[model samples]
Target: MDKFLLQQQVLDRLAEDLLQVEQALREAHETATHEENIAENKYDTLGLEAAYLATGQARRAEAIRQAMAHWRQFRPRPYDASQGIQLGALVCLVDAGGQQQHLFLGPDGGSMRLLSGTQLVQVISSEAPLGRAMLGKYEGDGVLIGVGSIRQQFEVLQVD
Candidate 1:
């Protein structure tokens, strides 16, 4: 797949994930509010439990909102097809240990299932080691990634 197609795919996937998260957060918030209202008229034990659940739900809702805000400002440019590594490119690499991997620059979720044929590694942010190395790199570039105390070299075989 070319860079443009890959970029479009990533954007589409990200948008979909954002929508799902937003919906879930809305549902959770509504449920929590309902529970809290019901508990307000009940015993202290039930009210406490409801308050706890409501707090947890509120936290999750905030997190999802923050993530959605971040995604909204994320503008993925068209992939540079000139042989170098660029954002939105699907990269295939062989690690030093001889393991083959496919890395997709995307949000962290169950979206890995969308990558059916190859192994999918979700890069939630650009600061990660592998993610950092892949940025501004070209095909055939070799990068060393630190995993815990061990450092492994990965060769970029292809960029899609």
Candidate 2:
């Protein structure tokens, strides 16, 4: 894989997302304070619900904005093949059925499915269970992850 190409792709996607989120938040903030949104009766929850929804969206957008900033400022350094997985690492995991999945560890982009060419790249965080397990593990290493009642196994096939 071309690291430079992938980095640019991910960065572009995140930047676009940031713009859309900001615009939506701005529009919502404007409509949230219109006179029509004011409640006529104390028992009526329409205004309250509308206000809550706007506030919630604002908070969510704020979090994404902060994370997008981190992504923009992050400088991805080249890692040796032997090095453990960290930010900017593209990892390939193999399941029992020999199915392979590609995941890109990033500073911040949220959970997103991004397509570059014909491949789908999934953004993952170090806080995630599988992401945590991938740290410091070399090729041929196996890990078992359990979420709720399901247990899954994965083998580290490659890291680039």
Candidate 3:
């Protein structure tokens, strides 16, 4: 799969998420300011609750905006053997049971799955645990990742 195309797809998905978040933020803000929601007594906290929800929605919208900015500035380059696996590398790893998993290493705030043709590829940040373990690893290299108390092992099958 073309890395540039995949990057574009990620950006498109993030854009959609941003739109949704903004809509929710707008609704929450309106609800918070609505006259009907104003509290008449101390126990009546509808307006206060709505204000808190609006604040949370605003924060979520800002986060999505930042993620979109990061994705826009990101550039995916061709993989080099000397560099091993890094951001922009499409890596395939195989477990002991011969199960193959595909991952696209990318920038922050892109931990989501995408469909490339019939295969589903997981997009992750290099700072993530699995991504960190795969970094600087070449084909045929062994990768080990520990999550909580569980350990998972996989061999690098391909890097492109």
Best by lDDT: 3
- Give the alpha carbon lDDT tens digit for every residue of 32-124 in model 3: 899998899999888898889889988987887888898889988899999999899999999989999999999988889999999899999
Write model 1 residue lDDT over 1-160, tens digit each, in one string: 3434433455566567657755765665565566554654546355455456656656755665565555555555555766466655577888877887876654332133234335454443455667777777777789887889988898988776
Candidate 1's C-alpha runs over 4 A off are 1-46, 69-75, 81-84, 107-113, 116-123
Of 1 and 3, which scores higher on lDDT? 3
Order of the predicted models by lDDT, top scorer first: 3, 2, 1
- True-vs-predicted CA distance for residue 45, candidate 2, Å: 2.8
Give the lDDT of residue 55 in candidate 3.
Answer: 93
Candidate number with the higher TM-score (2 or 3): 3
Off by over 4 Å in 3: none
Residue pairs in steric clash, candidate 1?
84-138, 85-137, 85-138
How does each model score on TM-score? 0.58, 0.86, 0.97
- Ten contiguous residues with the weakest lDDT in model 2: 107-116
lDDT against the true structure, per candidate, is 0.60, 0.75, 0.91
Tens digit of per-residue lDDT, candidate 2, span 51-146: 677787778777777877777776766766667767778888999999999988776555676776788878787778888888777778897789
Clashing pairs in 2: none
- Which is the winner by TM-score between candidate 1 and candidate 3? 3
